[model samples]
Target: MTLDERAARRRYATVSALFWLPLGLSIAPLVLLLTERGMAMTAVAGFFAAHSLTTAALELPTGGLSDVIGRRNVLAAAGLLNLAALTLLGLGTTPVLLGLGMALMGAARALSSGPAEAWYVDTVHAHAGPDAELRTGLARGATATDAALAVGTLTGGALPWLIGLAPELGARLGEATSGLVLPLSVPLLLGAAVEIAFVSYALSALPEPPRPPTPLRHVLRDVPATVAGGLRLGGRDALVRRVLVSAGAAGSALATAELLTPGRAADLTGAPESGAVLFAALACAGFACAAVGAHLAPLTARRTGGGERAIAASLTTSAAGLLLLGVTTALPGAFALALAAVGYGLVYLGLGATGPNENDLLHRRVSSTGRATALSVQSLALQLTAALTGLIVTVLPPGPLPWSLAGAALLAGALLWARGGSESRPYAIPDATGGPDATAERRPGHGRPLGGRTGARE
Candidate 1:
C-alpha cells in the first residue's frame, strides 16, 4: 500500500472507534439509569421505541444530506448532537426530558451511519484506484469498532459496580449533582466527554475531496432525488437488492438474540442481578468475537472464492448459530449456558464477517456520489426489519420459536447468494440534473478476487 492509503486506513479505523466507543459506554447502563430515574419498564420500552422510530424516519434524509453537503460536516453535527443527548440522558430526571434525549440520540445515529465509511471508501479509491485492497482496511475499521465496544462495555459495566463498593462516594456524588448524577449516570457522562473528543478528532483528521458548491435550494432539491435514486437502486440491481435483503436478515437475527438473551440469562442464573452481569460479559465476548471475525474477513473471502460466496457462507454460519441457540433452549445447566454462549459468539462472528464482504461488493457497484445514501438504504432495511422482527418475537410464545424465525430469515437471505454469476456493472440511475448519474468507471479486470490475492475463482 502507498503511504496515503495506509494513512487513510488508519484514520478510518480511528474515526470508527471514536464514533462507536461512547455508544458502547452507555449500552450496559442505559436501561438501568432510566429505571433509576423513575421510568417504569413500559415507559422505558416506549422511549426506546421512540428512538428506533426517529432513527428509521431520518435515515434516508440524513444520508442524502451527507451526500449533498459533505461527510465531515454531517459527522461533526452528529457528534455534537450525541454530546447533547448523552448529557441530557445522564442528568435529566423527567420522562419528557429523557424521551427527548433518546430521540436526539436516534437522530445522531441516523446522521452518523454512513458518512465515516463513505469517507474511507472515497478516500482510498482516490488514493489507489477502485481495485485497491479495501477488505483489509474495512476489516481493520470493523475490528477497531468492535474492540472499542468491548472495552467500553467492560469499563462502563464496571464503573457503577465499583462506585457501589464505596457507598459514601455514591451518595456524595448524588448529593453534589442534586440527585441527578448517580453512580449509574457516570458512564453516560464519560460518554458525553468522549463525544467532544470525537467531534474534535473528526473535524481535524478526516479530509474529503471538495464537492461543487451547492446552494441551500440545490441541497433541498437534490436530497430527495438522491434518496429516491438510492431507493430505486435496490429494485434495479439484483446484487444491491441481495445486500439489502441480507441486511434485513442480519437485523432480524440480531433482534432475536438481543430480545431473548437477557431473559434466558436471568432464567439460567436464577437472579436478575447475576444475569445482568452474565449478559454484560456475554456482550463483551460477542464484541470480541466480532472483532476476530472482522480481522479474518479478507482471508474468509480468499478461501471462499469471492465476496459473494463469503457472504453466503457467513450468513449461513450465523443461521446455524441461531438454530443452535434454539436447540439449546431446552438443555439443562452449565452445559446449556456454554452452548448458548458459543451460539451467540457464532452469530456475531458471521455478522462481522458478512459486513466487509457485503460492503466491498456494494462499493464496487455504486459511485461516490450516492455511496452514503446507498449505505443508509442498507441501514434502513436492517432497522425496519429488526423492528418488525422484534414485534413478532414479542407476540410469539416463549421457547425456541423466535430463534427459529430469525434463523429462517437469515437462511433465506443466505440462499439469495447461493447462485452466482459474473459481477454486475454499476447501475446508471439518473442524477438530479436529469443525466445519467456518474459512476466509478470500471477498468480492465474489474471484480477480481478481493485484494487481488488469488485468481478469479468465482
Candidate 2:
C-alpha cells in the first residue's frame, strides 16, 4: 500500500527512534561490563577496534544489499544481529565470546546505516513526487533519534545506580541467575529486548514496493557494481563530493572533541570520577541541543534560501564554536568552564543542522537504485576520517593545537560551499523519458559530467 507524506514521515521518525534507543542504552554500560568481566583496558580497546573495523568493512556491501534486495529485509536482519550481539555481550564471560559479540554489533551497525533514511525518502517520493518537501520530515526523524538517545542514556545510567541502592536484592538476583545477571548487564539485556520490538515494528510499518527476484549470483554481482557506482558518484557530482568532504571535516571535529573532552574535564574537576559524571551530563546536553538544531533545520533552510547555504552557515557556526573552545582553553576559572560548555553545545547544534540539509541535497541528486549505497559512501567517509583523526589528535601536543586543527578542517569545509545557493544546481540524471535531463545548467570549467558529451548541460 502507498503511504502519504504524513504517514511516511511519522513512520520514519518512529523507526529512527526505535533503531537508535538500544544503542544509547548500551553506550553507558558496555565498557564497564567488559572490564567487570575481567578484560583489561587494552583488550577493551581491541574489542572497540574490532567493532570499528567490522563496521567499516561491511558498510558499502550492506548498503548495496539494501539497494538490491530492499530496505525492510536489511533492517530486519540488522535488528536480529544486534539482538544476538547484545545478548552475548551481556552474559558471556569468555573474551572470545565478547569479541565476537562486538564484531556482530558492528555488522549490525553497518547494515543499519542507510536503509531507514532511504526508505523514508523513497516512500515520500513515491507518493509526493520528486520535488516534495523532505527537510521537515528528515529533521523530525533526526530529532526523534537524538531525543531517544538522550532519554535512553539517562535511563541506562540510572538503572544500575538504582539497583545498587538495594544491595541485598541485587545479590539475591545475581545468585538466582547464577552470576549471569548483574546490575551492569541490565542495560545490554534491556537493549536486546528493545531490538525485538524494533524488528517487529520495522516489519509491520515499513512497507515497500516489491523488488523483482534475482538469483544469488546476480545479487552478488549487482552489489559490487552498485558500490562502485556509489563511489564514482562523488567523482562526477561536485555537490555530492562537497557533502562527503564536509562529512569528513565534521568527523574530524567530532573526534577531536571526544578524544580530548574527558581529560579536560578531569583536569577541571580534579578527579576522574567527578569528570565522568560531568561528561555524562554534557553528553545528554549535547544530544538535547542536537535535537533542537534538527527541529530548526527546515527553518534554517527557508531563511537561507536553500540547503546549500544552510550547510555553509551551519558549518561556519560549528567552526566558530571550535575556535571558541580553543580560545577558552588558554583561560582559567569557572567562567572559562561555562564558555567551554557553550562551545560544546554549539558544536553539536551546528552538526545536527548540517545533517538534514546535506542529506536533502544528496537525495535530490541520486536515484532510488543507488540511494542507500550513496549514503553508505558518505558514512564510510565520516568513519574513516574520524578514525584517522583520532590517531592524529593523540600524537599532537595537548592543548589548543588539536582544537585549532579540527576548527581549520571544519572552516575549510564551510568554504567549499561559500559560492552561494545560486550555484546549487541539479546535475544530469536519467529521466523518465530515458534521456539525460539537464535540470540546471552547468557552470563553465567546473569539470565534465560523467557518461555525457563534452559541452553538454549537466
Computed on alpha carbons, the lDDT of every model, listed in order, comes to 0.87, 0.85
lDDT of 1 by residue, 24-112 (tens): 99999999999998899999999998899999999999999998999999999999999999999999999999999999999999999
Which numbered prediction scores highest in lDDT against the true structure? 1
Stretches off by above 4 angstroms in model 1 are: 1-3, 424-445, 450-458
Per-candidate clash tally: 0, 0
Which of the numbered candidates is closest to the native, going by highest TM-score?
1
Candidate 2 error regions (>4 Å): 422-426, 430-458
Candidate 2 lDDT tens digits, 1-458 = 99987888899999999988988888778888999999999999999999999999999999999988999999999999999999999999989999999999999999999999999999988997765667778888899998988888877888898999999978997999999888999988999999999999999999999889989999998898888888888887777889999999999989988888888777667789988887878777888888888888877876776677888889988888888888877888787788888988989899989999888878776778888988999999999999999999999987889999999999999898777553344355321111244243434322211121211211
Worst 10 residues of 1 by lDDT: 426-435
Question: TM-score, each model?
Answer: 0.95, 0.93
